[model samples]
Target chain A: MKIIVSLFTFLICQLYTLAQVNQASMYGLDTSFLNYNTCELGAIHEYFSYHAKYPESTMSLLKRVQDSVVSHPIALSKNGFITFRFTVNCQGKASHFKLYLLDENYAETIFDKTLVLFLYDFIKGLNGWKIIKDKSGQHILNYNSYFSFQIKDGKIISVAP
Target chain B: MVKLYLWLLSLCLFCFNNSNASAQEVVVSKIDCLDSKWQESAEQGLFHAQYATGYMSEEWQSHCDSLLHICPNFSYIWEMKAMPHIKGGIYDFASLNKAVSINPNRQLPYRAFMKCIFSKDYYGALLDLDSAEQLVHGGGIMDHSFSFYKGISYLSIGKADSAVLYLQKDVAEQSKRMGLGNEHYNSLFYLGLAHLYAQQTKQAERYLLASIKAYSKFPEPNYYLGILYLQKNERLKAKTYFQMAQSALNNGYNMNEDNNIYVDYPFQISAVEIEQVLKE
Candidate 1:
């Protein structure tokens, strides 16, 4: 009985440590919620920082890929928005991916695990991100970037900002 | 040496006093309300909020929340707090709706603009803009007339006929205000798009040419005109416009709107898309 109690306490401590891993940054960024990976390097700026951009204008290409890749399941008729938030380092590599799902009213919601994982992998595989440049066209900086997808009846209707 | 130190100290004091006076002036010049005491508090709150490093930072949110605690009915504070969330796609509607409830005339146009641009809620945006028009006698907001935004919102939701009506009104109003042939390039571009989608190809061609004439480097209208020409089997004209669009995009010309930093405008095209058309 004594040995079993000690084993239970050990398990509880492990679980508590796992829960505490997600802490807020100085900027109050929720660092670990639904994060696919947590390997951010150096300091990062927000996507809305001055003159940030992707390497090229290929968002329509991305939309085309999404339309072709996501196979619709009849059971997955949920309509909402899925936001993928991540950071691109100064070298333009993306990491620290996070996901948030919301209904039309902007309330938090859930999605199918298969759909979520597919999106996670899709965002993770995206490359050729560009580092933000200052107005003078000098000084490269890392920044966070995000894109949201509007889904209707298991199909992506549009992608935004 | 002692005399030089004393002079330096006096200069420092003068500079500090001057800066402090300017800070106070900034607050006073920006805020004015009927109640003097409330106005003072509001100004101080705004001054402190402005010191935060980034608008989307939690520090900014907390400062806005603290000010709201004291002046719960402050509509501008609610609007300011909602901005970062909207841009980030966090999508909290309570704060923005609260602002609209408090001061409809001042806040409704702003809410409509955000809904149309950031959230892509076309129906919701139309409702808010309609309210704003009734209250403010059809004034503009965020550098666009209500008819201009309504036109875009209608086009977004596939209502081409309504888009044409409002866009025509916008063109007439803007031409009356800014003189003939001086309407905004965007108004003309969108009006052209509406005509194209409504199957009026000749009107589309006229306004699209007008858009490119107004702003030579504009890319979207060029690409659409290429499509229109391609459909008519005018491959040579289509290729010229496609190359023009590609060249403009390569030179970093884009939808030159102020809010595009936060969101892509509806129907905005890209360099890759233009290239694809050229290949076709």
Candidate 2:
């Protein structure tokens, strides 16, 4: 069991980037590049660089999503987390969305196509992202952010860090 | 000219990589940050590693990795390296296992804490906590008793009976040590949740109210109180509690757990839930 877990961890680390690439290809959906109207033209900063924040509380945003996004029960057989990694630019516009799905055990997996697409569209449509200022509060910065949805029995359980 | 540019770029990368390490080398002597359990070299490595640029950064991780290379048996470095992975929602048990193997008394509870809270692997947490209980004497980690986390894990995994047992033990121990009404608010909150799950509504309400009294701005107890009221078909009371929960959240009150910034706690509620309940 230990050996298997080690091997799994090794594979996950080695193929982490590849998994993102494959997610798009496997689903025939290119969530990789989104054309945002308000993105600044410069180097995209790391998330930890400026410690950017969302415009509203993450819980509020998630609550709104759970109430509205999953309009009907999805009969998908899988239960896991759907995480979207994206960039929010200086102008508070998010782009470059990448999706990663993992099971309760944290192993990578896929969910229903309709469900995944619905979530992808919902995240892409989300606005009012906030660009955090530097420590001196002078410069506006772009940063990467992750949005993850915990799912159980085809229902949206919660949003997480 | 092109070769000179390439050379300069390589030098810049090298400098960037070693910037934090160089800082460590300069100040490691004056810091006085040493863990007596490990060797001096390992302690120094950990101290220096802590001075790395930022957590989850390549430089910071590489600094830890380099330290591990020097002192492979150092559990702190392994734990440090595993943190980013855990917070990022990747459960790297191998590194955590390595840490536990080296120092079970110190790392087991930590691993259990991570499993219970961050990874939401309740069963796994219980296993580690059980082992930690065997190895260590009476103690706590991350500011709560081991039994507190065990209770939480059992509650999370739907074993309300076990959760209530452990949580009650935690409350008794805490009350005995710190005095009544002074146990950790989370303990009361989870006790309420466990009772609620077990259909023991009166007990649930008692503990939930105690939790609220302990920390009024805590949204979770208010939210669960809303659920309890709803279950009792008290719509107006439920709405009021839900509104309170919503208001608390809007005011930026959240679970005060140390790692709440990195992961959501079990039974955490959101504004939408409150709003939905209000609408109903």
Alpha carbon lDDT of each predicted model: 0.72, 0.72
Which residue pairs in model 2 clash with each other?
A: none
Off by over 4 Å in 1: A1-41, A55-62, A69-76, A133-140, B1-52
Q: How much does candidate 1 score in TM-score?
A: 0.78
Listed models, DockQ each: 0.25, 0.20
TM-score of candidate 2 relative to the true fold: 0.73
For each candidate in turn, the TM-score is: 0.78, 0.73
Candidate 1, residues B81-124: lDDT per residue as tens digits? Answer: 88877787666566888889998999999999988888777777
lDDT for each residue of candidate 1 in A1-161, tens digit (9 for 90 to 100): 99999999998787542211211132233344225434334456787665565543435744664675556542347887667676676566666556667766655676666566566566556675765765687656668787677666556656667
- The positional error of residue B45 in candidate 2, measured at the CA in angstroms, is 5.5
Error of 1 at B54 (Å): 1.4
For model 1 chain B, where is the 10-residue window of minimal lDDT? B5-14
Instruction: Write model 2 residue lDDT over B15-38, tens digit each, in one string.
Output: 445765664454433322244433
